[model samples]
Target chain A: MARNLLRAAAALTVATLVGCAAPSLQVAEMGSFHVGGRTVTLSGLPAKELVFTPGAPPLKLDPNGDFEVEALYARYTRLSNPKAKFPLLLWHGGGLAGTTFETKPDGQPGWENFFLRAGYDVYVSDAVERGRASWARYPEIFKSEPFFRPKKEAWELFRIGDTDSYATDPARRRALPGTQFPVAAFDQFATQAIPRWGTNDAATQAAYDAYVDKVCPCVIVVHSQGGNFAFNSALKYPQKVKALVAVETSGSPNPDTYDFSRVKGVPMLWVWGDNLGKFAFWERIAAQQEKFRNSLVRAGGKGERIVLPEIGISGNSHMLMMDRNSDQIAALIDQWLARQGLRN
Target chain B: MARNLLRAAAALTVATLVGCAAPSLQVAEMGSFHVGGRTVTLSGLPAKELVFTPGAPPLKLDPNGDFEVEALYARYTRLSNPKAKFPLLLWHGGGLAGTTFETKPDGQPGWENFFLRAGYDVYVSDAVERGRASWARYPEIFKSEPFFRPKKEAWELFRIGDTDSYATDPARRRALPGTQFPVAAFDQFATQAIPRWGTNDAATQAAYDAYVDKVCPCVIVVHSQGGNFAFNSALKYPQKVKALVAVETSGSPNPDTYDFSRVKGVPMLWVWGDNLGKFAFWERIAAQQEKFRNSLVRAGGKGERIVLPEIGISGNSHMLMMDRNSDQIAALIDQWLARQGLRN
Candidate 1:
């Protein structure tokens, strides 16, 4: 018995070392690229002498030149042995970059790792004017100054707390009851937010279209503002889009104006988290999406919605992908994809 | 003996499964933030209607608004059990973002993974007007329009080939004999290059200063144009900066104008690749750096230079980190860090 216990201890040590040392997946290919933007020229601007470094002589700076703006950047990781039928694309929302799907603020493995482990080639994109997709000059190329989101606004808008619950002091801020979001990491989440423009929706859509043209026959998972782009892309290229999964989509196409019949063959799933009914803003957005979904179903399209609280999961914020039960949600997504015959 | 062999096979199978299932490291914390940009307001721009989606009516777009511009973006990964005494910050060069240290154009793991595996926390950054650090309005806030680098220009400028070696046709372009850069992935490397403004150097330097102030008493690894910022930063905050590593630094302070004595106590390393003598531009740059290095050493500074070819490691281009022998060079840096007493 003593010998058996010693052997068990030795086996446990080896197992622990192996578990900490190995990588989660074997990556076959990984790289990044930019797609879709036009070049613009600016001439007749004045030249100036500027000091680039301290104690150095000023150098002449020429202002007239041609520039490239509004391009979309995408980074992809293809697995050595993928189990899915098609590649997966993860898109982020307003004021955020492709980092939305990366490691979470609380140091947890995000959906990117979860999906990669589940066996899919994942492509995460920084759309026009966001992240590595550099922005254009405002009032000339971009047509407007960029807008910034304050921390207070994010605290309320993300459904983490009621409007009155937020305070200047962290200790005073009260999150919704049983919130799944890692409230302690709220400041960390805020760091991912960047300035966004109100006038570049058309430019952003064009870039997303170009991205879809470059890479298609793939599945798309979008959140918030990305919903409009993914929805429009699927409508425009139904044959290329295998499936669409939207998490708390902030906006959708107007069903009365757009043709839902164009995407009858495409399967789509809409996911919503808990405490959505606590605010009128979310209620209005939900009503609009419900109307759009109803129209699509009537037009013979495969559209489905999953409300987390109704299905026994609770206390999730709008940023559900970063929530505590994020893995559970990812499992549901994997199960849904398999049911749709997406498994290899 | 047969039973013992059977047990061994079972152990091997278990190890293999565990190896493929675990992550390389346990992360203690990971997140990102933006730093150093002033707010500006723009007015009197024309309002326009934007067609955000196909078959939908145009939405009104107001161009007048307050804007935030010229901020730098930084992402960090802190290991649970760090072996290095200080965090490592990786800064990129002109026309490139933090992606320079990520996956290589050829799909092999880049320096980010290499140093992470070496047991140090890593911080990667996008300097002002690059990547997630969005650009400002040209001829207004920026004072110059951006400049784009043509593929042929990058081919010659990066020292992958001679000026006469670049061609419009891929098959015709010739790399220098025994080049270590993955010539086949040349086109892929071009994707990371973004438009840069010549006039924004001051803004860029200011942002870098802000970054250093926020994250200091740290080690810095810089490449190309990043050389100037890293050098200036070290000179200004010598106590905070433990060491500086410059890889193929394209620019440096004039030893006649700047004082190198400020960094006398800080250890520094200047790394260079092969075939630098093939171009007069590179020769001039090398002379400047050599002068600066000599001045630092004369000032009782801990300065060292490593020419790859001199060390029997040849065939490297300006982008040594992305070259095939990148891991070998990383091992060299690791050894240097150990020698500096940075190993925990």
Candidate 2:
């Protein structure tokens, strides 16, 4: 009961933390593109591959065919006003696709449109083996089986609400108060959930690295789990990244091991929703991020940590980029980018 | 950890269930009024009271002073169109006042304006010893110490979100995935959380009964703990209650003891948000109400249970009346009232 009380108390921060004011511009153009993939040649004996179809003959293929791996898919939305200095690249976290920056589940426009409207060309991408990038079969190129996120894990790890909220009994699901994510369209959000593997990092990193090489000298917006790639990418090629915007990202480049001097000129912004200290998961994430930020600062790097509540916006969850006030936050980001000289 | 999972699962219903369609007509004429209060007379000892001032001498009352008890306060918003067949009386639940029907904490208009605009004279009331109906001193007219709802309990019991969402750490608070409550203005919602006591039921019941008697043959919209009084009052005076709309109510009159036949002609509507089965507390309330409804049906009573998600309206919390789409819900009730043949 005491724990329940504490849990209840912690939930309020989720409701009252993140928010936005309004928008000043609108989108003018939207487009899409794909980049970064490699074909692997097989030298061993021929391997059999079976393809099944409904009410049709199955096709069998021999190992003579090469497998395509580590391809990245991207969609670009360019604004007519062209106020931003360069295109903004949006990188989604693990198990998610470029759809994160596209239309919302509730049919509202996504951040891609909002940023475009705010005068910046926006590029949303699907990392290797995710979304439109497509994955290769195991034992050939990949080593392990891909694991899917259970609905329960999504509700908890995503901080949608509490664990009990996803109970089979419809009545038990109580959302934390003040959550801004469109809970009604959660099914839409869940539709974006895909299979992921822990062992795919090496290939994924390679694909992302290639993507950055292609789209250098642009602003980067990274979400949960994508933080590591964004940080490492920015560190590896500092001249390519103008500014880094990390939205509730889960990982970062090791502050101790990474070459901090590389990122000294790159301004980074870490954004957080409400209720960080309450949940053990979030508390740990926040602490580590803070440490990372401190380390960066100690190394004479420039960065800012923007907690939503500190700016009078409240009740935002981790998915702030897809929230009802997504545009508002996007506008705020636009303003932040302008301050960083990444935008006009 | 399992319990936490359960809690997280239970919290989802609070976000995604219970909703309303958009309103077809916006209110045209809007207005307000206040009424209902009385003073108690004493016989033997002289009743004297003293009033304190900030920078002046204290004022004293004479021995003829009388205390006021069980005086309900009501604010009536009359519509010029008068499309409804009867006046609508809004009764709030436990620990809350008539302000539930007023302007929303998020600065959105409350149900009072919506109903009035929909063409009903909306009577919003503060039950005895609550809101404008000021409580008397303990040991005199009142008994026992009143307990206040902590912000934490409000977040939990109210189905706002998870515990961590309320943590003081700005980063820890995460709103549920799909909550529609105006989380940004939660402080305003908390302001309405006044002191309440379990022992005040009798007096509250009497006051409610008296108020119903004063305004008979009206449609009643009851919320939360107010369900008990609304049911009993309707049963006791069947002809006075034209119809009843109970929104996320916590309690109801037992079917075994009550004369169900008395309420047979009084149509009732029970509305529930998402996730009743997730939280044990709400689960019990929902079960009991279901049983009560079944009993009413057995007695040949006409009643309908409107589970938000079952009907396709999702992402509503327990405080549906205070949600972002509150007006839409109000319109739904209006449609229901028309279906009941109570609207013009």
Candidate 3:
């Protein structure tokens, strides 16, 4: 568990850059849909589909006597690149949806584009109760009202700057020197922010697992809180996931109890951003991930960690996909995918 | 100096959102320029001007036998909004250039547009030795060679995540859950990275002051390291700056002995991001800024601290201007300006 395998392996990355080739791009298909869950009885209330039409009235059609509340919203963009070996499934973190991989808050193309350009058939999804994934009423089906993330929590927890800085007026908000987060586009970043409840994790995990079952035999790219779901899913269906890329993920399978040996076939990678030591909360999170990765390797599974700075790349935040060099980071993944033979 | 003003500001800030009014906008003017510096002699060689033209050839012209090395590169955008306010000058943090206020690496319109749309002419500048601002050979004209910022240093110092995370693989990087930074675009952020030398601070500060002098009676928005230049400029020419808005500024006027009353006539605003306590480095920075602000207030200057979180707008990083909600932050500044009667 305490091995510094990298220093001696010679594979300990020194310094390098991802590919910058702009291949002939072609989009095969792009659209969105709902996945997971079925109707269940809720106090004997009937299950119904509610439809709202713009410039028109709302309508409700009841089919089953059971309530449906856990279907997740998802969008997939597949490229017609003949060089692609496997489709890449993108799972976003807590309080956010597939938008995390779509267009940036500042209007730039997201990882979906980068991966597609790199010959990936990409699938982006909104977990249950996030983004396009509609949520049921709280205190009824949800059991608890959703708590909105104030801007303060983000400033403190996200490592954007000192927590006290965000407490200042918006005009006075100071970014840490050399910070790569597009501070000017913070409002745009917040547009992707949604209300999240601690009580929804179980439901979210279930829906995500179902998503994996449906989109198996594909590579997985998970971010932040999505890390947990990806880890759990890979454990459940190892053969389906050829390779796993976890970006700034916070969740992992319980290292003490989980049998990581099952995931031995799946090549796993974990990427991190700049300043981790600044935030006390991330210490435990980092430790958790390290334990999980170590457990996998000890069990004969392959795993690698790439700290942006250690590799000579820096200034990335938790939202690396939206960072200025997101394309470069994607290219790094592309390179890794090729090495793993996950790329054609 | 250790006062927790936010906790006491319950009545100071309630729940309120920045303006979201998208006004009819028009581009009145846009152009770039070089500002400040005098010709200087280096060694025994005569100074020469070297110019490079696209699709043509490079030209060197010797005129005054003196070379100008530290003039900065600047871009100005003036919008034709009839409901105009005082022009705004945006000073970026250290190691960054005018691009900080221009288009985001993610391709979103920058704060320059938001300010222009809000009826303020804006000037974005690349300090000397940064961006388009040309540099001279070290030990000849300049004293020391520039030092490049590695990826690891950026990750830790910038507060993106833990160093261990970045040291993993690029794909394995894990952002803290709930962070507002665009981690995907980290490579994009790295693209802006350049070599910085500690010896150049004075020259950079001098160039910034000169730029302010050239564009006087304008509102100033300074971030991080730019805080030093903004404070010094305001102190020297308080009359020229109708108002000063320092965003998460770490540097300040010499609080111990400087004449704190000289700039009392100019209205000032100090803004901060969230989580100062998390980063130990920021504690002193926050303290420095707080001490300076208090001294200014005691000197009869009108100033206030706007903490983004204390006001319910959380999740902003040091680079608040490039954040998704940058426009909202700008709107807050706009509102404050109107209150100060800075509007035309």
Candidate 4:
């Protein structure tokens, strides 16, 4: 059936390419699914009338019901002839969805495309409560009300600007000197930020574990908040996880509390972009993640940490995948994967 | 630059095609952005401690802030050489995101892929407060609390099952006889349902108008509740909307209230699946939409309505795009587009 589809796709390609360029990649299949959510029933909430459309009579809005929330949503694209040993999963960071790995805020092709071009089936996901992974009623299924990430917080905390550099006016918001982030598209980047609950880590972790179980024996490329999930998933399912790529992971397993030996056999790569020392927050995060990496290495694990500046690459911010030199960074990761025998 | 990228893609294709099938299609550019949102500030909300991680100390969660909300999120893929004269914008319905057009509940490739393969640049959007377009604080930025769609409501209201056929137990649930919807995947279909608000039609419509302004002189394929937005958009920007394909649109502008002549020059196609008349609710929706269609035709507009049974295609549910015969339905739409001179 797969071969037949490929042959048909090839024929369609010919018919469709009359005046077009040859497609860059031949996809065998593409699809998406929601995984790992449990149902929760709520009652006693007041009912109201909902005007679903203008001029239409209202429909009864009943709040007492069984709702399914906290599922992880993943969309995958598989190449007809994949060159990688395992599929690559792109997981986004805090307050963002899988869109992090898609198009950059500056409207450039993102890592999802770059990696697909480099010959791996790609799966991009929205972790629990983010993007298409719908959020539950706050203070109901979720323990706390969701928190919104303000544009100022994103600018300052994401290492795009100095502590006092973010201003209400766009013209006054100062980016770090020589920053690689597209400062002109800062507002565009801010739009991807969604409401995130502070207490859903366990739910998020469970959904991610379900996701890993559903589609693994694969590679996971994680960023920021996703680092914790990837590390936990690897620790929990070492055999299924082929490798780990952490991009400036913001949090990590407490090296003193968790066992790192389980992932010692899993090849790992940690990448940090430029301008890390500008903020003590990033410095702290880097230090904590470095300790975890060190612990993994100390346990006889094969792990490599790449600080872009050390390799003569500079001026990258927290959003390396969306940075101006994102392709360069992806190339570096691709080379590392190739060295790890991930390529066919 | 495009030529260079295409040449480079072609070169890479050659090197990568050693044992792999040729890629199904070539992509020239892919990207996403959020559009049409205004910033709002809130104050006097209480703060709390947020336990972001399992073992970490809680961070102070301050609710007082300025937030960017009610934005529309859209992702676009432009082919290397698109075969359509204009790009195709896919607008999803209520309680769902662009994922509606992505992958079906049964893991099948969906209309997005079908259209893309048929040679149109596809743009799929999550309307305001849906999917990647984040929701705002209810009863604050929004006028009312968001409502959740229960699984039972979906099964009955979407024409997947008889009104009394829904059961709490999966094994006991009964699909309408000969329904094309994959009954086993009904639970999977429910996962795409998100929290939809009651009083946000204005916000939703405004965001959609802004979206049309940003990305039109193109075709629009809408589903379910998206009918209202597409109709309003065509009415508002008649020249920009080359054509419209509305599948099971749940609501329409009251023919008595709105001027239909505005869209007289735009071609329109309304598709209805089988089993629509199984419930009075669906019958009412179809009748309302049919009246609007009739009004369009009476105004000298070019419009066609295809009831699946009338075309000798039967056993379809309201979720026609996700039905077993989804590809056949997509093929029908493609043929219609070709006949309408939408093809290159």
Candidate 5:
């Protein structure tokens, strides 16, 4: 069946990406967030459940897996505005957490503050590891899609062997001791911590679900790595999603690589550089069904793509959004979003 | 109309970029190129007659003009195996440029070479000035789509406004006073020329057409800006396009901002970041559109967004694909593509 499928499509796939996807489980949960500055705290917040902490809101998750769930909301200043849509969950990239959309670098303008000032409600969260959180979990590289199958057949499709296990191998343990720390850290980050912080986290998922059920998000704005989490969560609870704006993709490989790709018709943007974009090396994996590329074509989402060399951003770092000329990035995105016909 | 259109997509997608009928266009031009160390002589290159030379490739409107074109192709080599299905121009990002598929760093495997070693024809060329040349006649931004009403609309979509004006901007006045230079040369390359280029130009178009006509490009591996060009270009020639792998998108906004629901179809990977994918910045623009975030929800595409806190691509510039760590990037693209089942 696989060979035949390839012969039929690869022979003439004016629009099909080769070899990608597998059905998996779709998990959903929710949690409450401590909303920050915004107008109409009630409206800006996604339509979900928010339970105020009886006393002090616990920072750490319950060790025994018992944790109270609540919905996060914004104390937006412009609640009176009837035209205001429900505030959204504005997530930033990694590094320092907390600086909501309301505040930006050097007080120039924050995504939160700008929206709030414009009569829009927003909930911002920093993608911080939250203390020893980054290291606590025993992250494993669980294959959402089986990576260890008939290698020869799938090898041409561009699958990786047990690449990261180099450090753990007993034979090479002495030769590559330094590789152990970062790889283990990465594994944990990808497996345990990510699911927890992302929509997959049982408590956080519950809280997010509660919020979504309450306010009914008008849109979700995510940047960098947070963009993936936000979108992944939305996929888990697609019915609760309205729209998304992914700033700079970090990991948007194949949909089947994950477990879900259904929606009640949501709008999204996959931002990238000029000509082509590869989230962590598209050249490596783009051969398989070319997930985002092939699927969109098959689905018939004839949208426009923007590829620029660098909108005046020249730096040597992982953060392109925060480049020296970030204004260009910001202004371009704003102008484009404004063009999207989205309401404030 | 422009306002309404922008309102629809949430971003100004001036598009339908393409070349016009010109008798000067010819077939099968050949040339030799030495880039990133490898030197190969291309034979029977398509659109050879359009090579930008003194007079061989004449301009569309100007008889005594100079113009040239380059073909574009990309393929990934298995980091584990050099000999594999080296499909050329078979991968790409949706909204970014075409070159985003391969790494831009030297001593690194060019995706095209990867395929070449893997036994596939690789055709790549430079994109600049105009489809038909005499760089003077061609503006920095060319019509990457088909000829449409309101030429500005297409330009707006691609976000290359004031092309005629920018061409005359005195900022980068060539050398001394008054003398002018092509806008592509202004980059602080620290030298008179730069080797890294775009997946555009006549040569690329011809190559794309040829690939479409023959193998049917099952996977379109695009990153960053190439997404825009690839999406629109594929739109113009849908028969030639199979599937789309639009990595971090920057061009797509809401074709209509108010209508957050209607999106063109194509399976998509909406990768997002902490902020907007920095493309270009200009006056009157602020705020970043979570492009990948928003795009995932576009009307039709089935999208899986992956957000990572850190790409761990050290010393790598976002103008990646050519920057350092391209192998890692390629590995990821290859992995994604493999999942899609387009190994060949």
Candidate 6:
């Protein structure tokens, strides 16, 4: 009787402590691409990829921000590549969102044409505010996220973009309530969308489970703070993505400085602007770049900080979100992929 | 060396699983009210006394479903008993939201008149919609709360108005966004709002703490399904709210009935309606009421199932939220309050 009582007490103790384990997530794969100079071959498209279905409604941009626009990519609808070494997932930088990977620069075909042509099946989405999804969709998508506060305490306040990140037009800001808090939007993306899109969200989860179930060696090439999206998503869903290329982007404040207790691993590439600090204004990100990289490294991630030297013009790294330095960045990514034995 | 390793392992395990013990909620008393035959009071008010601040923007209800009225006692800036009971934070029923407590019964005042005249401060907010704040300011009032699903799932699907309850909503036949598998909105409420309004929400934790730093006998009165809100909020911030009055409500579906869980400890009251249902509706509630009451009883909380038949009217309980029956219900509440030994 005494032994039985002790066993029952022990069992009750464990149940109270663990309650239930966070469920394991099974990630989906959207196949890989090959990067040959400029012409890209596209492969294995996960039918449910976050793209406008061909002949589907054109992606609507929040009317408030001049930064947003969605053009239905007719070709993306039929693109598919199976049995590739790695699938390409397009990630956007903070303050800017959308599938359109065009950076702010002259003579660049935006990363959209860059990756799509490189034969890599790329998937892109405006995390909440910046891109195409209606702003009204927010309160639901970020259902369980807490208001990230003491943000002044937990994180180094400003992220990829700050005061300058706001839309100039009052109408645009009106269109997106998310504008009220841009950084909160990013945190929601990493903590909410990552688990949900591929696994947690019921609607998206089923699509993921049916298509990309655990197959890895995928690449997350993110622009800006979308760097966190790629890294956190991969970290939280490691089995789904392997190598990552953060194109002209700095590391997110999650892995090292913030309470990302909700997110956890994945190898990463820290492709930051070589002249991130050149900007007279929001040059603070450059200061934290080293700490960001070191944190990811400390947390069992393979991260490299890439700050491209001068884009065609002498400017700051912030412009990289819309910069025209794809060919150079693409090559660097190609090199990274080659080393990872990832296709294309 | 082996003992040290074992000790380190045990400590790590405890730290990871247990998390910090939820801080004890320091509940204090504010003021009281003798109403509807019962006397009730506020708990966890910021000043250890019933504090009322005036001068809020007036309420607006031009919407087709809601009637227009000045909620501020003929639009008087604002008034508080100062020594009155804790404010009754009212939330709208599921589909209908904040409109649930509006007292527009053709002539007499709504919740505003009933409570204000009675000397208790009332906070009726449109927990789901944003624009309503100027007039109704209910809800997350958390770091950022969201009492109901963002777009009013409860109102559209489970709405129990003067005529309908979740039981009667034809839409209930179809699965709602968050309800497809039958999880209670209560869980979603706690998961989201607690982070914002309760001590859990990082943004508002300090505010919630500071606000409730003094004494409170805070009494939360939730009508209909808002009971879920009252119950969950009290569970998460028990120190902030001392007593919970679930007027005309039963807890949401629990794990024993479905796959959901029940909240622990808050006292509850389930007032039945005579104006509702064909005799069958009340019978259904009667049938379900026992199980609901039994569940709370087993959880170590006191509860009661009051029927309108107990009063002179056959079923006046359903009229409790309106202007007509407010006084009677108020009297009964006064009686219950006196029993608490809480006096103003």
TM-score top scorer: 4
lDDT of 3 by residue, B195-215 (tens): 445567677778877877887
Q: What is every candidate's C-alpha DockQ against the true complex, given to 2 decimals? A: 0.15, 0.01, 0.01, 0.40, 0.01, 0.01
Instruction: List runs of model 1 lying over 4 Å from the truth.
Output: A1-26, A38-58, A64-66, A164-178, A213-216, B1-89, B103-123, B133-220, B229-243, B251-267, B273-285, B299-302, B307-344
Provide candidate 3's TM-score on chain A: 0.85
For all predictions in the order shown, the interface RMSD in Å is: 6.0, 28.6, 25.4, 2.7, 31.3, 26.8
Candidate 1, residue B342: Cα displacement in angstroms equals 8.7
Candidate 3 lDDT over residue span A81-150, tens digit each = 4376888999988766666776665655568766765567778777776644555544556765444444
- Put down candidate 2 lDDT per residue, A96-145, tens digits, no spaces: 76667766757666776566555677787777766545555555566654
Candidate 6, residues B176-266, lDDT tens digits: the string is 2221112232211211111011112222122223222332346666665445545545555665675566666643444264311233434
Per DockQ, the best of the predicted structures is 4
Model 4 chain B is weakest, by summed lDDT over 10 consecutive residues, at B14-23
Which model scores highest in lDDT?
4
Worst 10 residues of 3 chain A by lDDT: A10-19
| TM-score (0 to 1) for chain B of model 2 | 0.84
Arrange candidates by lDDT, descending.
4, 1, 2, 3, 6, 5
Q: Global lDDT for candidate 1?
A: 0.79
lDDT of 1 by residue, B1-344 (tens): 35433443454354334334534455454556677766556667666665544556876655454455667888776777889999999999998899888888787778876677667889999998788776665565687556555566678889899887876566888999889999987766765776687768777888888899998889999999999999998888999999999899988877898788789988999999998888888899999999989999999998898887876779998988899878777767766788899987
Q: Across residues A254-343, which tens digit of lDDT does each residue of candidate 5 receive?
A: 465643336435556654432123123434422332355446445554223333344322221222232223334434444445555655
Return the DockQ of model 1: 0.15
| Model 5 complex DockQ against the native | 0.01
Off by over 4 Å in 6: A1-78, A81-84, A99-108, A129-217, A248-267, A280-283, A295-301, A310-317, B1-344
